[model samples]
Target: MYLHSVAAYLPAAIIDNAHFTRLNGLADEWIIERTGIRERRKAAPGENSNTMAIAATDAVLAQAPAFAADSIDLIVVGTYTPHDTIFTAAHAVQRHLGINEIPTVSISSACSSLLNAVEIVEGYFAMNKARRALVVVSEHNTAYNNEEDTIAGHLWGDGAAALLISKDRMSPADLLIREVVTGGAAPVSKADEAVTLKPVERGIVMPFGRDVFQQACTYMARVTQTLLDKHHIPNQELTYLIPHQANLRISLNVAKQLGLAPERAVSNIERLGNTGCAGAAIALAEVWDTIKAGNKVIVTVFGGGYSYGAMLLERN
Candidate 1:
């Protein structure tokens, strides 16, 4: 699969560290030192995951005006925080785009949802089941998170991203999807209980921050290096690293493990907080235009469910 276009949507409402100070009594410096998140975006009144997904899709369409909505044969949305449980965000996006008779699906693997969605599109392309695909990742974390929770509540944010992918390269500037690999570590000790979000009970909670940090730091680097080794690409040859926007410390740790410079690792968590699965995609959209031809980029992700994945892309 080739990426033809990409776009992201961040809500206008900005939730700064001071808001958490007032709500949870956590100081600004404390939050920043621990999570590197000074501020985050929150969906405004009446804005939800579906609406944000549509906004991102519209942005993608706007970026690639030649890519018609009717050409999209597959629509996949990766979101854990959906507005409605029955009516998914994928269908909502398909409806908003006015494209019908296409296969639309939604899947969630916590923060790793974006890469999983891309892998799904890869499968369709491999089987010749789809020609053009639309992948949207949206998160409405604040809707299900408890602002009062002092543990992980402050880390939640709302955002969305859309990617226009084709079975073959559409243009000279299209990003070639070299490979995508995903795996689960739920079998690891205490993996299932490390982080959780229960809508009826409590919101997003991280009972074992140390465990999550250790596993995230380990697996993100492992999966990234796996892809590099598989392609026989050396660590120094990597042009950029886009890690999951869960924590700045985790991203730095992964970069160090891979012997890559910290500056080469793209990060938006400092300003956007952890926008769930949309974080990496949002970062990709922000830096898409600056990437040069022959550049090799890797996007590695580790999510709360202990799911991990990575994707290798090259500009050709």
Candidate 2:
């Protein structure tokens, strides 16, 4: 199926590298070198998931006026940081937009957050479960960052984006999808940081840079190749490739190893840092601004759970 339209909202607040370093006890050089991020967005203090989701959905729905807000059959909000544990971001967006009759749910997969969100939507369309759907993913937690967790702190930013998908726009042979393969070797966290922090705690945690890079590159590359081989789709024909905006080092390394030219890879990491779930979705939304009618798109993401996924789709 085709992505009917995409839209995003980066709040007015822009935090620069020097400010980040000074405020969080990090060095501009170290953060940039490791993550290829100079600066990223931080939502205003009063802003929360509900408000941002409304703004994001307004923008996304506007771009697809061909479909009405009432036509949305599914709303999947992929996120880790939420205003409250009880209020799912999807439901928040639904209520904000006055479209509460649809099915809504939240999915969290760390860096693979939005990718998993996309996969869920794909299933709905594939099974004739939904005609039109909206995927809203964002992170709104810069103030909640852990001071000691420098790695996660220095890399994350807050922003939200939405993607509108519809069946009417999809072409019969579009790389709609052949198969999806998932693999994560083991647990990165004990799921019991209670002695220190709760497993469900949404705040940042100090991540081992070396360990993250190793896990990301291995899992991303393996999953991507497995999907490619399974679909009989070659690596050379991919027109666009978007990776989870974890770090430019990890992104480029995966592309280089996968035989995709440097230009084929798309990134906003340098500018937006790691936007949690919205990383890959925002990257695709940015590219959507210039996409032609029938381009090939291959989206692969390596995320927070130490998880990774790949989707091979063609433009309608």
Candidate 3:
């Protein structure tokens, strides 16, 4: 079990809760009380999900340059916010990678996009479906984040992560992909408003922060514990708990309930906030250096499907 490579990308624009408050009629205290979010990033003009994911993919592939794009047998992209209406994020990524012949698919678990990608790619390897693949994820949550809701506005960022998986020298210990689960109706917005064109002018806003919290907390904990018990891995032993950037408080509380120490649980929520499907991936990317060749990591995510999913992976 070995991880061939891991990489990520962050947009240049930064948005703090205070700055968002000026646009949305929400208060910082209210946002902080509910979600432990300080700030999030926004993708600039022409900087959509594809461009972001490409950056991370380049970095990860650079780490393992021996492999070529055409050599990748499968491509799994995680995202709810895609760049085009008709195109899957994975297809766009393949186009950008200049490798369109390979199979590609997109997973939209809101914040769990990356985990789902990992799960799918892992299954491909475990079931002997395909051995070499790229798991790519990028979420520009601010694309629809209503600057109006302090809860949602301050809790998102733009970032991406990519991991090249192979059966080669990535190390057997790093190749473990243990569990996967998902439950939800749809992760998209349920608002009555019609989908509009100009995303930059009016953001994609989620008005149901409280409901999201309740659903995410319960689902993340249940799936996380189930995976841990099934794999015989203890939360106490995991080197890092990479959670989808939802809110600071929610992440903290979930860690406490799972018996993981605050330090052991890694989060970029304070600085990066939530990048939706890319949340966990970006967080993991930032901490890529700290993880050794064989660190066991627990990646959990509860996203907008009202949907949630969780998985376990060993670091390469």
Candidate 4:
């Protein structure tokens, strides 16, 4: 599969650290030192996951003027936070785009949902089931998080990203999807309860922060290394490392474990906080234009479900 174009949508409402300080009594320095997030975007009154996904998709389509919307045969949305569970963000996006008679699916694997969506596209391409696919990852984290909660509320943010992918390269600047690997770590101790969101009950909460952090640092780096080793690519050869925007510490730890410079890792958490599954895709969209031909990039993620994955891409 080849990545044709990508774009991201961040809500205009900015929630600074001071808001958390006033709500949860968490100081700005304390939040920054732990999560590296000074501010994050929150969806406005009318905005939701589907709307954000549509915005991102519109931006991506606008970027690729040559690519017709009618050519898209698959639409996949990755999101854990949905405005309407029954209607689903995927169907909403498909309806908004006016693309008909195609397979539309929604997937949720916590924050790792983005890569899982990409893997689904890979499967469709391999089976000759689809050619051009539109994958959108949108997260309305603030919709299901309590700002008053001191545990993990301050980390929540709202954002969305869209990627236009094709079974074959559509342009000279297209990025080839070299490999994608994803798996779950539910068998690990405390994996299932480390983080959770029960919209009907308590919203999003992190009961076992230390366990989540330890597993995220371990699995994210391990998965990235797995991909690199499989392709016989050295760590120094990697042009950029785009890890899930969960925390700055986790990203830096993963980069260090891989023997890569911290600067090599692309991060947006400092400004965007954690946008759930949309984090990696947003980072990819942010850095897409600057990536040169022959550059090797890795997008790795570890989510609350104890799911972990990595995708290797090369600009060609």
Candidate 5:
């Protein structure tokens, strides 16, 4: 499918490294050196996953003025942090976008949710079930963070990202998702104790930092290389490696394993922190303008639930 436009919404509250420093008595440089995150955005009161998704979708539609609201026949929201348990974020987004009676899907595969959402959109197009679709990912990481935990409490932020995917080109210069690959050999479920963001007495649990870190690098590198190999696209041909913005070290290690320079990878973790499902999309939206036409960009994501995937995109 062709990507019409991309947009993102980052909350205004900036939580810098100093917040963690004061909270845990760790040096500012220590956090950066460990996670490569200097600061991240946190949602303010009243801002949640649905609101952020609406903001991002509005921005995307504004960018592609010709793509009417009625044209969208499918909507997929990739999120682990939903505003309401009874109503999916996709329901809220569809209502706000003013589209009616279309099929809306909510996916919660942790970090790979965004890529998985795109994969779903691709499947609909391949089945001739949808001509136009909107895929959005939003996460309110701070809301579930265990504030007492030093390792994960300060490592998360909140943001949303949206993308317009269609079988037909919305613009002549649109980018195409040329290839996709998903799943893995890793036992992500067994590593569940290492990483989590689920209900635990009105809050969320987190991963054991050391265990989570080790597993992340291994799976991220494996899934990324799996996608590249499927397309027979050499590492040298990849113009950009956009991995989930969970950690700087994991991204760098994936690049190294793939035989690509770290500069070829795009990252916003230092400033935006981990936006969960929204990480790759938000990071991609921020640097969309810089990617040259015809350049090959690979987006690889590994998230909680042991979920992971990758996509090969080429700017048209």
Candidate 6:
């Protein structure tokens, strides 16, 4: 399957590192040193994950004029933050897009949601179940975050991104996915509550920063390298390495271990922070026009559930 188009919509409100420093009584430089995030976007009141997803889906649909709404037989929304638990984000997107009732599903794999959605879409195409598919990801980090809590507040942002995939090649594809792989293993040692979000709670609990950092880097690198090795693609051939926008350090460390140049890794964490499921997709949309035809791009992701995956693609 090929990505016909991709688009992103970020909230207008900007929360810089200084805001977190002021609330938590930490130095501005300390936030930067730890997360490498200078600022992030927060959705205003009345703006939630579903609204952002609709906006992003509208933008993607507008871009792909050749693919009509009626042709979309599949809709997949990857998000942990939902406006309501009763209705899936995909259903709302389909309704707003004026498309008929189709096979719509919601994925809640935290950061790896988008990658997992792509994998599902690929399966639909391979099975000849969908001629065209719509994938949307909305992340409202501010909605569930506790600003008073120092750790999670500063590391997250709010945003949404959409991708239109098709087997018919309705328009010039942004990239043709060469291969996708996703898997994860439990921690060998006793696990701590590194991250948790309950339906009744306002936000998630994220302690054990050191453990999360170590595991994130290890699994992300492992999944990325496995995909590359399986396809016999050298690290040097990758035009850009887009890892989950969890932290700048993790992206840089993965690149360093793979012997990739610092410039080859695509990163927007310094500006947009970690946008959960929308991170990699947003990064790709920001650099879509700059990626020349035939350029190879690899997106590796690790989410809160200890799930991780990687996808290798080439601009068409």
- How many steric clashes does model 6 contain? 0
TM-score of 2: 0.88
Q: What digit string (tens of lDDT, one per residue) describes model 2 on residues 1-316?
A: 5667777888788777888667767888888887899988888878876567778889988877776888889999987777766787887888887876677888776667776777788788878989888889878756556645665667778788888877666433223543445544447542222112233665677445667677778778778777777767688877777877878998899889889998888999888877877877788888876665466677787765567788776655
Candidate 3's residue-wise lDDT over 1-316, tens digit each? Answer: 3465677888888787778668866677776667667777789998888788778788788876666777888899887777875677788778878875667888765666676677787677778777789888887676766656543446667888898877555443344554566555354444122122245576655656565666666777788888888878767778888777877777887788898888877888877877777778777777767777567777788765556677677754
Please report how far candidate 5 places residue 145 from its true position, in Å: 1.1
* Model 1, span 1-316: residue lDDT tens: 7999999999999999999999879999999989999999999999999999999999999989778888999999999999988889999998998887888999999999999999999988888989999999999999988788898989989999999999988889999999999999999866888999888887788889989999999999999999999999999999999999999999999999999999999999998999999999999998999989989999999998799999999998
Look at candidate 1 and tell me the lDDT of residue 131: 94
- lDDT string for model 6 (1-316, tens) is 7888899999999988778767888677988888888999999999998999999998988877886778889999999988877687888898897777678988888788888999999888889888789999999888888888877767889999999888765556457888889875445331336777775855866786677777888888888888888888887888899999988998898888888998888999999988998999999998888888878899999877687899988876
Candidate 3 segments exceeding 4 Å error: 25-30, 126-129, 149-151, 167-169, 172-175, 183-203
Go through the candidates in order and give each one's C-alpha lDDT.
Answer: 0.94, 0.74, 0.72, 0.94, 0.85, 0.85
- TM for candidate 3 is 0.85
Query: Candidate 4 overall Cα lDDT vs. reference?
Result: 0.94
Once fitted onto the true fold, the runs of candidate 6 whose alpha carbons sit more than 4 angstroms away are 172-174, 187-192
Backbone clash count for every predicted candidate, in the order shown: 0, 3, 10, 0, 1, 0
TM-score of each: 0.99, 0.88, 0.85, 0.99, 0.95, 0.96
TM-score of model number 1: 0.99
Candidate 5's C-alpha runs over 4 A off are 184-189, 200-202
lDDT by residue (1-316, candidate 5, tens digit) is: 8988899999999988888778778678888888998999999999999899999999999988877878999999988888886688899999997888888999888888888898899889989999999999999888888656776777888999999999987776789888778774346545656666557555556657666667777877887788778888888999999999988998998889889999988999999988898999988898888888878888988877677788888986
Candidate 4 residue runs with Cα over 4 Å from true position: none
